[model samples]
Target: MGSIATRGDSKRSGNQGMIKTHSRSRHKRAQALAEMAVMVPFLVIGMMGMLDLGRAFYYQISLTNAVREAARYGAQPYYTGLSPACNAIPPATSPGASCPVPGDQNIKDRLAQELSGTGFVVDPTKIQILPDQGTRVSNCGTSGSCQYALKVTATYQFTFITPIIGDLIGNPLTLKTSSLFRTEY
Candidate 1:
């Protein structure tokens, strides 16, 4: 049979051990919270950087697609901008009777229409549309001959959502995409 005194002492010791375990658990919880507070900012900033980078990449791809579409439009035989000025022989400066080349503003409007819903604003001044008639080896009057090459270029401004990243990189990164296509006149 166990003595009553010994049983009482064991119970008290068990209670003290439980109290010590509770105290250690509280300390560990506080330490974990402190660590989380220190790490959270860095984690948030990293996530923001990734998000911004993804957005920039998406916009870049969109801009490239827009330019490709615009170039495709210009590559058609019907677009006035694709017509060569003065198909005459060298030294003959007379502008031919073809419809006047569509002005930069017209081309810009077409590009803007293609860029609609992309969340990117394109500047007309930054865009350049040019026709390479001199490079055409085949005669335009011939059937099934590619006449002229149209070149379209534009720059997209990508703004970052996070200020820290913006300061590290430029406020707005300029991403440029150009597309050239031969006209099927």
Candidate 2:
């Protein structure tokens, strides 16, 4: 009888230990779930913000490159969109010659073509060939001869993929980039 009682008592003790372990595991799982519930939103938002930032940076770089390319093209000695009599500037001696610098409309069109699928459509009016400075005498070779400096600027409105980030900061950030170059021709 004493042995039977001792055996029964040991069995009850083992069952209690198992129940405690099971309850502890359940508690741990619930804790982990709660932690995840609290952290997942933040993690998701952070990831989204990172993505938006990357997109903005990429667009900025693309815009800068595009403007730089256009500026380089514009810097070449080109016509001033004038008639044949006034076509040649100091650099261009030949009348009605093909100038390195293209017309404003031409440059805008070329830039638009270059930025196709880049989500940018450059406006000709917005592109400044050389704002506040035009047809300056070239410091390059001779004082008599003239050289041109070209500057191109473009502005883009960037919209975030995630509206939450936009709400926090601001929706549709205006991104502007410019490129400056000296005329080679």
Candidate 3:
């Protein structure tokens, strides 16, 4: 009877050890979960900031390309079948049947169209054709004769999606791009 009692005591101690190990494992799992909960918000914010940075870079490139295309278009002389005509002044009226040829208004239209593909709503009012309607000569140097160039400028207000970052740097940022090209006619 004494031996049987000793054997039963050993079995009870082994069971108690297993129970302790199981509880410790449970505690560790809980600790890991608590740590994850604390870190998730910070990770999400960091990802959002990266996203905003990428968006801003993409938008800036798009604006630059659009302005460049518009300036290039404006620098060329319009062909009128008989000869290449360099129109010094753009039509004062709005774009319609009155202004059929490619001019300053057309340049603005092309810029707006290019920006439309970039997921940005372009305001026509923000597009500016330098010299308003005509070409200007710059970089004359000692030659006394300068090359004709056209300049196009555009502006857009970019809004940030990240609340914290937006607050840190004004919610809506203003982005501007300009391009100049020499006349090819």
Candidate 4:
């Protein structure tokens, strides 16, 4: 009878040890959940920041390509007539005075067209044509002949989706790109 009572007591002690192990595992699980809960917001914000950065980079590349296209278009010779009358002009004559160069509005239109479908609201006012219209002239040595170059510049305001990061830095960051090309006339 004494041996039987001792065996029952040992069994009860073993059951108590199992309960302690189960409770410890539960506590560890709860601690892991608490840690995850504390870190989730930061992880989410970091992901959002990365997304915004990628968006900004995309916008910048698109803007750069648009500017380059606009510059290329502006630099090319545009002849409206069947025959190129501008090509026969005297070497001493100024190209801007006789040749038909692409106006600022035309360049802006090309830029806008390139930027279309990009989800960017391009302000026409933000586009700048250097040397303006009817002034495409650069003095070339002492020959008195003019060399033409077109420069197109555009600026876009890039707003981040992450408000915290935007606020920490500057909201609506200005992204500007410019392209220069010599005339093919």
Strongest candidate by lDDT: 4
lDDT of candidate 3 over 34-115, digit per residue (tens): 9999999999998998899789889999999999998887775454433222233322332212223356778888888887
**Candidate 3 structure, TM-score to reference:** 0.76
Write the residue-wise lDDT of candidate 2 on 1-185 in tens digits.
Answer: 99999999999999999999999999999999999999999999899999998998888888788788777666654555554533545343431234444656666666777788787565566666663332432233443334455678888788899888888878898878888776554
Q: For each candidate in the order shown, give its overall lDDT on alpha carbons.
A: 0.72, 0.69, 0.72, 0.82
Lowest lDDT block of 10, candidate 2: 131-140
Candidate 4 lDDT over 1-185, as tens digits, reads 99999999999998999999999999999999999999999999999998998999999999999999999989865655534566564244545545566778989999999989798968999999986775664333345555466789999999999998898778998999999888654
**How high a TM-score does candidate 4 get?**
0.82
Residue pairs with backbone overlap in model 1: none
- lDDT for residue 63 in candidate 3, whole number 0-100: 92
> Candidate 4 — which pairs collide?
none
TM-score of each: 0.76, 0.76, 0.76, 0.82
- Report the error of model 1 at residue 29, Å: 0.7
lDDT of 4: 0.82
Candidate 1 residue lDDT tens string, 47-77 = 9999999998999998898888888776653
Cα lDDT over the full model 2 = 0.69
- Which RMSD values do the candidates have, in order? 6.4, 5.4, 6.4, 3.5
